[model samples]
Target: MLGMSTTTGHGHGHTHDGINWAERLGHLQAIDALDRDTHADVAQRLAAGLPEGATVVDIGSGAGGMSSAFGRALAAAGGGTVVLVDAVPALLDAATAHVRAEAPAVEVVSVLADAADPALPELVPAGDLVWASGVVHHLPDQQRGVNTLARMVRPGGRLALREGGLATQCLPWDVGIGTPGLQGRLLAARESWFERMRADMPDVVRLPGGWGRALAAAGLGDVTSLGFLVDHPAPASAPARESVVNWLTFMADMAGEWLSEEDRATVARLIDPHDSAFVGNSDDVFVLSASTVHHGTRPVPPA
Candidate 1:
């Protein structure tokens, strides 16, 4: 998905909203540091009972980390084809490289297309397993996107989409002793930015029921929703720490126009590299309060 700035009319004139490549890499690295085990476990569980040589599609495969994990799991089942789909070309490039590095045994295909585009299925083949991680919400019509994604899956195949509410997506401010509501304020800032996006982009659809209901509405059966919690108490990995630092700093930058002096001070301290209370410092532990996985299967006819 495009960064918040680009998605909300900030335009592609600037890559990553002025955030450097290191910070962007930090975000992807954070995925490995924080959710590597949880993502692998969930992918293995959901990908069970799959036939060898089956195909897998990863929608919005940012930096290809999750796609790489799925590719590795699918490779264990005698290898298969993995497709990485994303609107951004650079991301697809990174994803391709990452997937190849992680699972050389699997065939990897990269497709450049918007998740909300109706013609997506035409460009990509139907897959035995279709995975969309936080892709639907970025579309203009979430239900339409879900329906389109459902159609991309062959009968008897499974669909898994990763999404979560604010509570699950953001770390709480109370995790460290520095600022009591730093994280909470940052989340509020994110919501404020989202509101601005909604106002600016009226065509973009916002789903009320989120992923579970979207899958169900697409005629998927055996629908299930589960959540994984990543609670790193302290001494977080370098990548995870950097990711949080970048995130809080970005929020502060985005919300700078509206943030109160007190809130700004809190954000400054939270992102301060040398400050003991800084999120990315050795003393701070990065925590993903929760991460949710919603899945369902497309029904097949009886033999």
Candidate 2:
């Protein structure tokens, strides 16, 4: 269910793909809004080792934007095949349209495959590259996701992913370096958002055994991250700063029920509509283990 709606995604139209494409896409789009430069950064990781004419499968290829980028890349090296899979009909349709519109000769195929189904390999045509972003976290069962991803890759193929880790476990939303009296509110906000998320889309946000542990257990190779920033500094990068600001805004929303109108206003000031609070503001990294790219070969029966 890469794009299906769940409490985790605040009711976006997520599909029933084994991975939630909608939720993942929603998040990627959010990141895209600010972290635009990292587009190439991620593509390079996911596309590593892609050879001439290598077939590629994009599991949660929402709106088909990211997968399309890869598909075009494959075509550049050689006429490789691109298969876009998602349980969401809308996403599939859009992906198909994107392929036809952008890179028709690359052999783009769209399928309604759910990652959880053990039969997905049979359902999907084979490929040399397997890629997904922000996918594992949204799966109802992380272990299943690990298994499904492992199963999809052909021998010598790569399965790469970037998932949001529990970077920060409920901290003060506004306790910045210069902000005073933020510690009390930050602590309270952390408690409030945790309760709200648990009450809502607990399935999507809840991590089992942590992302790294789970990915390692899934037997993924080359797993690593940006080391999960506890709190971050506002980089000169606009997108990174925007990401931090948006996070603060979300934290405030999560704590809305527990805060007074005046306190909420303060929270908004820290992360809303404009860029005042962000000038040299110290950002809190969620300890997210950001920028994780994992690849491993799945064993196939000796033919």
TM-score, every prediction: 0.84, 0.62
lDDT of each: 0.72, 0.58
In candidate 2, how many Å is residue 5 off? 24
- Residue 299, candidate 1: how far off, in angstroms? 1.6
> Per-residue lDDT for 123-167 in model 2, tens only?
776677787766655565667777777677777666766665444
- Candidate 1 lDDT over 12-57, as tens digits, reads 2122222343335546656665677877887787788887788889
Compared with the true structure, the alpha-carbon lDDT of candidate 1 equals 0.72
What candidate 1 gets wrong by more than 4 Å, as runs, is: 1-26, 165-179, 274-277
Assess the local accuracy of residue 32 in candidate 2 as a C-alpha lDDT between 0 and 100: 44
